[model samples]
Target: MELDSEIKDRSRESPSPEVGIDGRDRSASTTRPTLILYSHGRTPPLNPPPDLKYDLRSIPNPPKNARDAHDGRSKRLREHLLGELKFVQKLDEVESEILEAMEAKIVETAEKLENDQDRRDDGEESRENGEEEGYESLEDEYDPTEAVLRVGCNCALGHHRSVAFVEELARRKWPRNWSVQLIHRDIDRRRGNDKKVRGKSLRWGGA
Candidate 1:
């Protein structure tokens, strides 16, 4: 009994395992790690200190010869316009050829129609006079060729060129049996803006 009492007294005198720094009881520290932090909420100092001054220099200006720059720009603009004009002229020539071909086709079709009518009339007369057994109209034998006029424009300036070409072709009385199709390929792809003109097909029965 005396030995047990001595052990109990020693146990009471021992330092607690739950005590931490600054005399705070730390029962939670026994089960997990404890972190002791001291913060006064002070901002960090800037490197090199706030009293340091910076010396900045102005950027150099470009050459002040405005006439040279203007001349260069004007030359470029003239060359571009000339090249566009040449291209448009070529398109005009092609359009003229197409229009002429259309006119020839129209004349040929009209002549063929007239001849067919004459032949039909002759066949009818022959059938009535007992020279033939049946009268068949030549209209059934008509086989007209299909022609399509395709106009492609590649720039804003060329757009007007294409329109003029179409107008001239229309004025020339293109064949009723021919078709026309217009396409514009030059446009800013990023902006998604462009113009397209489609022509109606001209057939024998109706346009």
Candidate 2:
């Protein structure tokens, strides 16, 4: 009887078996992974920590002299306009080029979403192959933390750059479940009784 009791006690002390979808024992981690969407100078009010933070300025081909340190597919409006400073502000060529580039970039980014071979299973320490380029370990690469990812930016007028990117990212296929919420720092900063708003807000529907 005493031997049976000792065996029972040891069983209780031993770690519980946890098998992941890949049939390997899961790590001792039970944290929910997070994907943050934020901009510079516009942090969320609660100041929550995020596992991954992608600034709107870091994406390739960003508007010149706009990004401070780091990134994304922010509309290069200033660039489009500045290049046409010599011509009238209503230049059709500039508008067409910007529109075309923006559309192409959106499609390109979308296509690159699920192009990884093992993004799903390789998220844990039980990696089957070598580590990916941007990640340190399978744990760091696929850490699941139960936390809200705060995203903010210096979009003074709103509905131009950061807002657009957030909207676009929300539509992408993430490796994990991500509930994205947008909080335009200056959603109404540009609106007033003066009747001067941030001009036309472009609704990038399918474009």
lDDT of each: 0.32, 0.36
Per-residue C-alpha lDDT of model 2 across residues 1-207, encoded as one tens digit per residue: 342233233322212453333354533433332334543223333245432333333323334455432222343543432353332232333334333433333333333332332555455434445555454433456423333334344343343445545434433333222233444443333334334222222221110
Report the number of clashing residue pairs per model: 0, 17
> Cα deviation of 34 in candidate 1 (Å)?
94
Instruction: TM-score for candidate 2, please give it.
Output: 0.30
Error of 2 at 132 (Å): 45
RMSD (CA, angstroms), candidate 1 = 44.5
Error of 2 at 76 (Å): 16
Candidate 1 lowest-lDDT run of ten: 33-42
lDDT of 2: 0.36
Q: Kindly report which residue stretches of model 1 are placed more than 4 angstroms away from their true locations once superposed.
A: 1-83, 133-179, 182-207
Which pairs clash in model 1? none
**Candidate 1 C-alpha lDDT tens digits along 119-185:** 7788878878878736444434644333222333222222222323322223233322233332222
